[model samples]
Target: MNAPLKITKVGNSAGLILPKEVLAHLNAAVGENLTVVFTTRGIELSAADPDFDQQMAAARDVMARRKRALRELAK
Candidate 1:
Protein backbone atom coordinates (compact mmCIF):
# COMPACT_ATOMS: atom_id res chain seq x y z
CA MET A 1 0.00 0.00 0.00
CA ASN A 2 2.98 2.27 0.55
CA ALA A 3 4.67 1.96 -2.78
CA PRO A 4 7.05 4.74 -3.59
CA LEU A 5 6.95 6.40 -6.95
CA LYS A 6 9.93 8.03 -8.57
CA ILE A 7 9.46 11.13 -10.68
CA THR A 8 10.52 10.71 -14.28
CA LYS A 9 10.61 12.88 -17.35
CA VAL A 10 8.17 12.31 -20.19
CA GLY A 11 9.12 14.53 -23.07
CA ASN A 12 8.10 18.01 -21.89
CA SER A 13 6.10 16.75 -18.89
CA ALA A 14 7.04 15.11 -15.61
CA GLY A 15 5.17 11.91 -14.70
CA LEU A 16 5.22 8.78 -12.62
CA ILE A 17 4.95 5.21 -13.83
CA LEU A 18 2.37 3.34 -11.81
CA PRO A 19 2.54 -0.39 -11.66
CA LYS A 20 -0.25 -2.40 -13.26
CA GLU A 21 -1.52 -3.47 -9.82
CA VAL A 22 -1.62 0.10 -8.63
CA LEU A 23 -3.35 1.17 -11.81
CA ALA A 24 -5.93 -1.56 -11.29
CA HIS A 25 -6.48 -0.38 -7.72
CA LEU A 26 -7.02 3.14 -9.02
CA ASN A 27 -9.33 1.84 -11.78
CA ALA A 28 -7.74 4.35 -14.10
CA ALA A 29 -7.32 4.11 -17.83
CA VAL A 30 -5.43 6.08 -20.42
CA GLY A 31 -6.72 9.62 -21.04
CA GLU A 32 -8.80 9.54 -17.84
CA ASN A 33 -8.59 12.75 -15.84
CA LEU A 34 -7.61 12.65 -12.20
CA THR A 35 -8.18 15.36 -9.67
CA VAL A 36 -5.03 16.09 -7.74
CA VAL A 37 -5.20 17.67 -4.32
CA PHE A 38 -2.16 18.62 -2.31
CA THR A 39 -2.46 18.77 1.43
CA THR A 40 0.04 19.60 4.11
CA ARG A 41 0.48 15.91 4.64
CA GLY A 42 0.50 14.58 1.08
CA ILE A 43 -1.17 14.50 -2.33
CA GLU A 44 -4.44 12.77 -3.16
CA LEU A 45 -5.47 11.48 -6.58
CA SER A 46 -9.11 10.82 -7.40
CA ALA A 47 -11.57 10.92 -10.25
CA ALA A 48 -12.30 14.51 -11.18
CA ASP A 49 -15.45 16.44 -10.28
CA PRO A 50 -16.64 14.42 -7.33
CA ASP A 51 -19.96 14.55 -5.44
CA PHE A 52 -21.46 11.91 -7.71
CA ASP A 53 -23.54 10.39 -4.91
CA GLN A 54 -24.83 13.80 -3.92
CA GLN A 55 -25.69 14.58 -7.55
CA MET A 56 -27.51 11.29 -7.90
CA ALA A 57 -29.50 11.98 -4.74
CA ALA A 58 -30.47 15.42 -6.03
CA ALA A 59 -31.46 13.94 -9.35
CA ARG A 60 -33.66 11.38 -7.59
CA ASP A 61 -35.35 14.13 -5.63
CA VAL A 62 -36.02 16.08 -8.80
CA MET A 63 -37.41 13.03 -10.52
CA ALA A 64 -39.72 12.26 -7.60
CA ARG A 65 -41.00 15.80 -7.36
CA ARG A 66 -41.49 16.20 -11.09
CA LYS A 67 -43.02 12.82 -11.84
CA ARG A 68 -46.46 14.17 -12.55
CA ALA A 69 -45.26 17.25 -14.40
CA LEU A 70 -42.84 15.20 -16.46
CA ARG A 71 -45.52 12.65 -17.30
CA GLU A 72 -47.85 15.46 -18.42
CA LEU A 73 -45.10 17.02 -20.50
CA ALA A 74 -44.42 13.70 -22.16
CA LYS A 75 -47.96 13.46 -23.52
Candidate 2:
Protein backbone atom coordinates (compact mmCIF):
# COMPACT_ATOMS: atom_id res chain seq x y z
CA MET A 1 0.00 0.00 0.00
CA ASN A 2 1.25 3.47 -0.81
CA ALA A 3 1.49 5.44 2.39
CA PRO A 4 3.13 8.79 2.73
CA LEU A 5 5.42 8.96 5.75
CA LYS A 6 6.56 12.12 7.47
CA ILE A 7 9.53 12.32 9.76
CA THR A 8 8.84 14.19 12.97
CA LYS A 9 10.78 14.87 16.14
CA VAL A 10 10.57 11.91 18.48
CA GLY A 11 12.47 12.54 21.71
CA ASN A 12 15.35 14.23 19.83
CA SER A 13 15.32 11.60 17.07
CA ALA A 14 13.30 11.94 13.90
CA GLY A 15 10.84 9.10 13.48
CA LEU A 16 7.87 8.22 11.34
CA ILE A 17 4.58 7.22 12.81
CA LEU A 18 3.19 4.20 11.04
CA PRO A 19 -0.47 4.29 10.25
CA LYS A 20 -2.77 1.63 11.56
CA GLU A 21 -3.05 0.05 8.11
CA VAL A 22 0.69 -0.02 7.71
CA LEU A 23 1.10 -1.63 11.12
CA ALA A 24 -1.48 -4.22 10.21
CA HIS A 25 0.26 -4.87 6.92
CA LEU A 26 3.53 -5.42 8.76
CA ASN A 27 1.85 -7.50 11.43
CA ALA A 28 3.45 -5.33 14.04
CA ALA A 29 2.26 -3.37 17.05
CA VAL A 30 3.40 -0.55 19.26
CA GLY A 31 6.51 -1.44 21.32
CA GLU A 32 7.39 -4.17 18.83
CA ASN A 33 10.79 -4.03 17.22
CA LEU A 34 11.27 -3.71 13.46
CA THR A 35 14.36 -4.82 11.60
CA VAL A 36 15.94 -2.28 9.26
CA VAL A 37 17.97 -3.36 6.25
CA PHE A 38 19.82 -1.06 3.88
CA THR A 39 19.63 -2.17 0.29
CA THR A 40 21.24 -0.86 -2.88
CA ARG A 41 17.92 0.59 -3.93
CA GLY A 42 17.00 2.06 -0.58
CA ILE A 43 15.97 0.76 2.85
CA GLU A 44 13.68 -2.03 3.95
CA LEU A 45 11.75 -2.42 7.18
CA SER A 46 10.32 -5.71 8.30
CA ALA A 47 9.20 -7.57 11.37
CA ALA A 48 12.06 -9.04 13.34
CA ASP A 49 12.42 -12.80 13.14
CA PRO A 50 13.33 -14.44 16.44
CA ASP A 51 14.60 -17.56 14.70
CA PHE A 52 16.95 -15.54 12.53
CA ASP A 53 18.26 -13.66 15.53
CA GLN A 54 18.97 -16.92 17.38
CA GLN A 55 20.65 -18.42 14.32
CA MET A 56 22.83 -15.34 13.88
CA ALA A 57 23.84 -15.44 17.53
CA ALA A 58 24.78 -19.08 17.26
CA ALA A 59 26.78 -18.43 14.12
CA ARG A 60 28.62 -15.56 15.77
CA ASP A 61 29.49 -17.78 18.73
CA VAL A 62 30.83 -20.52 16.46
CA MET A 63 32.80 -17.99 14.45
CA ALA A 64 34.37 -16.58 17.59
CA ARG A 65 35.27 -20.03 18.91
CA ARG A 66 36.59 -21.15 15.52
CA LYS A 67 38.27 -17.93 14.53
CA ARG A 68 41.40 -19.62 13.25
CA ALA A 69 39.46 -22.38 11.55
CA LEU A 70 37.22 -19.86 9.88
CA ARG A 71 40.18 -17.79 8.74
CA GLU A 72 41.81 -20.85 7.24
CA LEU A 73 38.56 -21.79 5.50
CA ALA A 74 38.30 -18.26 4.10
CA LYS A 75 41.79 -18.65 2.67
TM-score of each: 0.55, 0.86
Clash number for candidate 1: 0
Which candidate number has the best TM-score?
2
What is the per-residue lDDT of model 1 for residues 1-75, given as tens digits with 9 covering 90 to 100?
A: 888989999999999987777767777877777778899999988766557769989999998999999899999
lDDT of 2 by residue, 19-65 (tens): 99988988999999999999999999899886998999999999999
- How does residue 7 of candidate 2 score in lDDT? 91
lDDT of 2 at 60: 96
Q: For this target, which candidate reaches the highest lDDT against the unseen true structure? A: 2
Predictions in order: lDDT:
0.83, 0.92
Clashing residue pairs in all predictions, respectively, total 0, 0
TM-score of 1: 0.55
